[model samples]
Target chain A: MTDWDGRRWHDMGGQAAGPVPMESHDFALWEKRVDALMVLCGQKGLFTVDGLRRALEDMGEEAFETYSYYERWIAAVNQNLIEAGVYATEELAARMAEIAARGPTYGEAQDG
Target chain B: MPHDHPDHDHDHHDHDHDHDHGPFHHEGMSPSGHPYRHDNDSPLTYWQRMEIAVRELLIDKGRITAAEIANQIEAMDARSPTNGAAVVARAWTDPAFKARLLHDASAASREMGFDIGPLNLIAVENTADTHNLIVCTLCSCYPRNLLGLPPDWYKTRAYRTRAVREPRAVLREFGLDLPANTTVRVHDSTADMRYLVLPARPAGTDTLTERELAALVTRDSMIGTGLPLRP
Candidate 1:
């Protein structure tokens, strides 16, 4: 498991401490690797569409409907993976659970 | 069921008709119906009404001043280009700096004197054979520090809906068509994390200075819907 530092985590308004430096090539490689992991997690049902929707709601984002929510969730998950490092996978999973808990209680009308 | 009231003599002979003249027409109206007629006079959607109510409450409660919000908008309008141009110029001229930008965009932006905040998160991605597009599917969470205020079209629900679902078609509407095989990655920003696209440097103009290179980077290019300026 990645080292969990509660103190390092800040709310959205807090300042970012910057990303861990790596060469562009290395970073790209890592991104691909992480993307593969997310795809696997998604396929295995560890990250459901509902799960992603809930997560966005937890973050105070209300514009995401079902389909859009899933797509945006994947992007957010990938971002979290990159920023938190692979060791924080468990933490990411937990965050997803938190989101799912707050997922839309009622169906939303599809916007054209 | 037919009943005749009166009968009149009909003449078959007719004068020359003026066919060129047509009935007067307005821009949005059709001859058959009034385009502007509506059953209700409501001017706001549920979400729009909610947004207005919330903003009004915030003002009334003194949680946030209207002037402060306006100042933020003014600041965004002022500082957006600096961030976008700086990123593009650095990426074109310095490979090391580009690498840093790809790894962490907010930090790179800060180095250029732009503070990226008020977002829950920020992520930057790059592509060579592929192109990346940015949209806030949920709300307009933009990299205001880099690109200034997002264009009005970006805030429309149509753009938010179509950009993610059919990105290639959307880009085509914007007059940007990538090769059929070119990969298209759409990044959907939310209230949390904002995003900015790092467009590939265009060919030619190797002799141009950083400022000149920056000039070539347009706001649309950073959004991934348009290419860098040619000259």
Candidate 2:
């Protein structure tokens, strides 16, 4: 075994792993919204990208496997925003519950 | 903050302008030549619900606007490998600009009219005896302002970990095998600092125009996982 580097699970440098997966897909509308939100929120000083990274890293390795890329990202974004006091967890919970009741499709759920 | 006033919002109901719904949406390919991913009518997901909630909350609080979000999406969509390719092609043809790029990549890219904001970028050059590869082991940090969103593999755990440990093996898996004498250098991208590999110009391409040369540069080439296309 190699000497320990004290790396976190998300700090994956120089570790053993499988072959790189080459398949890729273009960003969808919702994914792009997540990306835009991250960028704009950072620009507005609501939170830094570092803060988002911290939230993602803290979510642990299991979340990495279970969550898709932007899923993890939106979670991190929301975490950071809540930490930044941009919105309260209560507000997010209420909003999500409201959203969940809207419809079964993304478009139908767009409006309140 | 420039246009954060609530009065500027066109209408809350008009957010669907970005989506093309229904049966005819799959008629043609996106600019990347791949079919568009099915969105909108797909079964609503947990994460999708969170996105809708967060976006609506942000808009409701006047922290952001729907128009701004739409504009931001359009701006990001405009950025792609093509932007980096143009920068690489220019560096190959213009010695002064290449020096500027190697010195201060962010400024050099700004000189070309790419609104990169405050990205601190570095340009690593690939030579006959030296090769460069980029990875973000800590997170999926990338030079997105210039190269658009990173490829999905770039954010994978396998590539992130293996690229730093066994670069030659990673390169080979990417269908790139450096000669025995060539030294391989791997750069780990960070939150504040991003690297763009200046892939070496393919040989026998002296007669090609800048635009033609740009076409030969691929996304993987800029990331140093693959080389520019041969003429």
Fnat of each prediction, in sequence: 0.00, 0.76
Leading candidate by DockQ: 2
Interface RMSD of 2: 7.8
Chain A TM-score values for every predicted structure, listed in order: 0.27, 0.92
- Deviation (Å) of A65 in candidate 1: 16
Per-residue lDDT over B1-231 for candidate 2, one digit per residue giving the tens place of the 0 to 100 score: 111112222222233333433222223455587655555656788899999989989999999988778788778877899999999999999999999999999999999999878889999999989999999999888999888998788988888999999999999999998898999999999998999999999999999999999999999999999999999
Pairs of colliding residues, candidate 2: none
Q: CAPRI band of model 1?
A: incorrect
TM-score of each: 0.49, 0.91
Q: What is the DockQ of candidate 2?
A: 0.51
**Model 1, stretches more than 4 Å misplaced?**
A1-112, B1-73, B120-126
Worst-scoring 10-residue span by lDDT in model 1 chain B: B1-10
B1-231 per-residue lDDT for model 1 (tens digits) = 011101111222221221111221112322222232210122222322222232333345454444444444334334555568777888779888787787787787777777665443344444667888888765556776677656546644556667777778778878888899888988888655778888777789789999888989887888877888897
Q: Number of the top candidate by lDDT?
A: 2
Chain B TM-score, structure 2: 0.88
Q: In model 2, where do residues sit more than 4 Å from their true spots? A: A1-5, B1-28
> Is model 2 an incorrect, acceptable, medium or high docking prediction?
medium
